[model samples]
Target: MGTLSGNLQRPVIAASAVCIASISSDFRDKFWPNKSSDTCSSLEQANSFSLPNSLNEPKSSWVSKISVSKLSNLSFVTRIRIPVPDINNLIPVSRSSSVSSFLYSSLTSSHALINAYQSAELVKAAKPASYTYDVSSTPSEVLYRWHLPDPKSIDVTGSSDCSSVKSRTVVVLLGWLGAKQKHLNRYAEWYTSRGYHAITFTFPMSKILSYQVGGKAEQDIQLLVNHLADWLEEDGKNLVFHTFSNTGWLTYGVILEKLQRSDSSLMGRIRGCIVDSAPVAAPDPQVWASGFSAAFLKKNSVATKGVTSEQSATIKEGNKTTVEAKPELTETALLVILKKFFEVVLNIPTVNRRLSDVLGLLTSQQPSCPQLYIYSSADRVIPAGSVESFIDGQRRNGREVRACNFISTPHVDHFRNDPKLYSSQLTQFLDYCVLTCCTSS
Candidate 1:
């Protein structure tokens, strides 16, 4: 797409006297039919007069009627002669130097109108087309929505500096296990509003459970990775990964593996990563059970349900009150069943090997970019200790690592419990990443 400044440089064609006369006549007939045709004929006759070679020439220098008819037959004049009623009165009658002045003024006004139309078209062109996917019919399908920054949020200028253009950072939001496109929209909006492109990706639960090493999900992920690589190559944009839960974390690992194998240079464009309630670093049956239980049971799942202050309090005698500490979540029957099921399923030779491969890649092959881990001590799905251990490993690998523990938040509920704090952390991390990128460049 062309820049807004480039569009404004387009030349505007001036309307000729013959074209203006025709448009005036048509407009008057349509809006003021009761008026006599005398005025129309007079306008035509006035414009029919030819200009003298010098201003001192006689006023009797009249052009033939045939010449006026040929001037009216010019292709561009007919094309521009729309019945613009608003400009009917702006049509000058006397064919003096004033006619040239009027053409300049009219073209000037039309230029602004054209520019507004071009700007609207540009914005519309930047919008992504609608996408539809059915996981039931296509189980391997991975769906995503791309959101571009608002044009109004960008500064318009004539400068050629690349930094002055639209934002070159794209934030990829990978949703948790049962997360839907709608669930990730709010997070996408948070990034897009700040002039960055946001791409939200979520996998269906069926696809995740039945995953194979070279299955349909892997095919879909490969395609998505290639798309991101192409985008980075075309625009020289950087990427920041924002993942939720272990499912998203593992998916990020798969993407990293694909990038490392296919195009290693693409990995260098990664600016930062913000992992939310994720990265168990190893395949644990209990963690898998907890994550799947939260995805399946939602609010009813003990692993996901939050304990409030009121629920944790107990009444005392003599009108005195005492605060009782929150109790640990008990293992429900469903969680027990899921844990046992995963214990057997995870032990299968093929499953064990595949999981180990991806986990190994994640632990060692990750890009050396800044990472911010957002988790909570109260999150039952992915333990706080596991996340802390992973962060320490990353630090030991010489990666810039930051961690925030929302002490009482549920799994993947850190942002919802305290959005202000969540947003502040994201903002600070993003700003630092962008500043570092600029300095390095």
Candidate 2:
């Protein structure tokens, strides 16, 4: 990934803007709104428990050339605990042990959910693979086409070098809904133009249940991650993640299983991940299994017509035509089968976001990769209180996060709201996670 913001707000032709007022009114209106009516009014800076300010930005650290004499106590291992939201369950996720050992032990005392993907077909199915992309493709390939403003619709500019940067040339973009963009062709052109090799990988979206037979999303994740893990192995280059919402659950959790193999050096190259509004937890899976309203099941009964087909049989739960094929179908009934297909298949939850999240903490088989968690008190989806609880939990556990940016934005689209700040914050976080880690090594 490159340092370029890939934001289509100002003309890519223009430079960056230094002064906040110089930024277009549209920019401020979108992200940095006057917080007169904020829900989390207490979001003002509370360093009572915050990461170092220097750590917030990219600080270059070089690989120490220390002699063996300085290697004191190599046997020492550290622990970090990540906070998992519990509905009064109070599950604790620690940072010690391998980071991949993250698991959540419930009062119920079992995690059969993780076993769903542990099958031979699932593992074989998870082998790294690649997808053919049409460079000429436009909105057809973009996941947020409808959400993105006409290129530059969300971005505004002055005359700064938003395109120029001197840090490492890796750019990890967390995509919305697990879709990948030929960012190199569009926003990444600035980095490519400057001779930077920009890499963009698709992230898989995880849901409450695995989508088999009819679940293409999880399959997409397995293949896409397989390809990325292999590529990272071939060329020992570090990269960052630009994750979107719960997709981070699918993106990192699925790879953690494969990365733990002794042969996967690619897993070690993950310098850091950049997440905004990451959903490491999920609602009860039973909610999805038996929670479907009769209306949703009946209206969306257009699952693959072949319940007996092997390819479509995985998701066939007892041939319950409606719910088995497409459980928790949220769309209104008037949509076409194709629209319904897109709604159902494309929205499949190959992995349970909530389950993997708790497991991410408990199953720390590897070192907890450094992360920059950014979210706003303005985030309506995950309450501001969640952020507060998260901060408190992280601090109490002695696991230090590089930084947490408390931006004054509305919701999950932190970057779109305040491109300049969001871009700057993200760039800094990437630098710290990657360049710093590289330097430290």
Candidate 3:
């Protein structure tokens, strides 16, 4: 089914294993939906022998899967031999503000989208730029991973004085549906830079549904939290989380509550939590803020006022009534496209209950340690208010909450939005999660 078109021979351990850079179906589908195969889920869940795709002109019938032997170090790229119609050939006009802000994990996404934005003639276009992270690998990257044993396979030993709990570490990176692969690297780097082990999703998810962003993702995130606790309880190691976007935020809320239910040693190891663009609250408030943000996207940006009331109605009642967000295809031209995928995929009512339950546990019941909330005000996806609202609530409840915001762009492009600014905030945040979480008061 799959063939190793590239290097077939394996080199002995130079670095031994580099975190797999290969783009899986999840990464492909989310970024290049057009280039994706009919079978995306297959590749993400299971290693494909022959990923079915037609590359090169020869045999249209000839399909290929990924080579599992080189799974760890190999990077697989889908080479489209034939010229397919440009799915990314988005509508050639933008109407929002000329400045568009985005989560810039790489120059590829930033330059690509920005240039695309320049030629568009849709509504108003405010094209905010993106920024990338500056740090290279510190000898620190391996140190963190080395310390944390696998969540499912860590060992625990009681200390002589009983003052210390010797356990393996586990950190999970929960990403949203449409998030890019590079962001994962950002995550690994962020955690490693701070001396935290990088634990990828036991389940690597690149493509998630819209509207399903919140509550459902919460289940995935929380599962890891609880599962790791059980993992550490046996091994006597601690658990940490580095969650991204909606998926990660939802998980934080869920796991906190689950841990509060159990007051064992596992719960004690729940030291620090790192949240990026994670919304502890529901998307409705963000939905409300969309009116203002959308207008900011048009050619001539408008505030959410009487003059722009009609636009708001069009977005809310325009297409899918069951869903609050507009369709991704039609979502173009305007900033409506910036709506977080969770808003489109998640059910609001259910997500609400989960969020409320989590908050209640953190406040009314046993409290969690400090949580580092990292966000960008210019984030076009989740509102700045969402971050403010969640952090505010946490502080009020007597939880340790620190918030850092990256302005001038939307979503994940903190690096590209303003690299210098992004770097400064990111390292500081990393230091906080590492030192604060590891050291006991």
Q: Highest TM-score among the candidates is held by which one? A: 1
> What TM-score would candidate 3 get against the native?
0.45
TM, every model: 0.63, 0.42, 0.45
Residues 1-441, model 1: lDDT tens digits: 013123323321122355455665664343233435332333223322223334333341222111322222223223343221122233333457744444444433332222222222223233321111111111122376556564444444424233332356778899999998889978987876666767788987656655666877788687568557655654456889999998889889889989989889889989889999988988899999888878877877766654464432322121112322332354477678888978877887777788889989878878888899998766778877899999999889888998887766788988888899999999888878755544355
lDDT of each: 0.64, 0.36, 0.41
- Global fold similarity of model 2 (TM-score): 0.42
Report the Cα lDDT for residue 119, model 2.
15
Ranking by lDDT: 1, 3, 2
Q: State the lDDT of candidate 2 residue by residue for 80-184, as single tens digits.
A: 111211112222323444211222122111111111111111112222011111121111132221011112211123222221121223444545342356422
Model number with the top lDDT: 1
Higher-TM-score candidate among 2 and 3?
A: 3
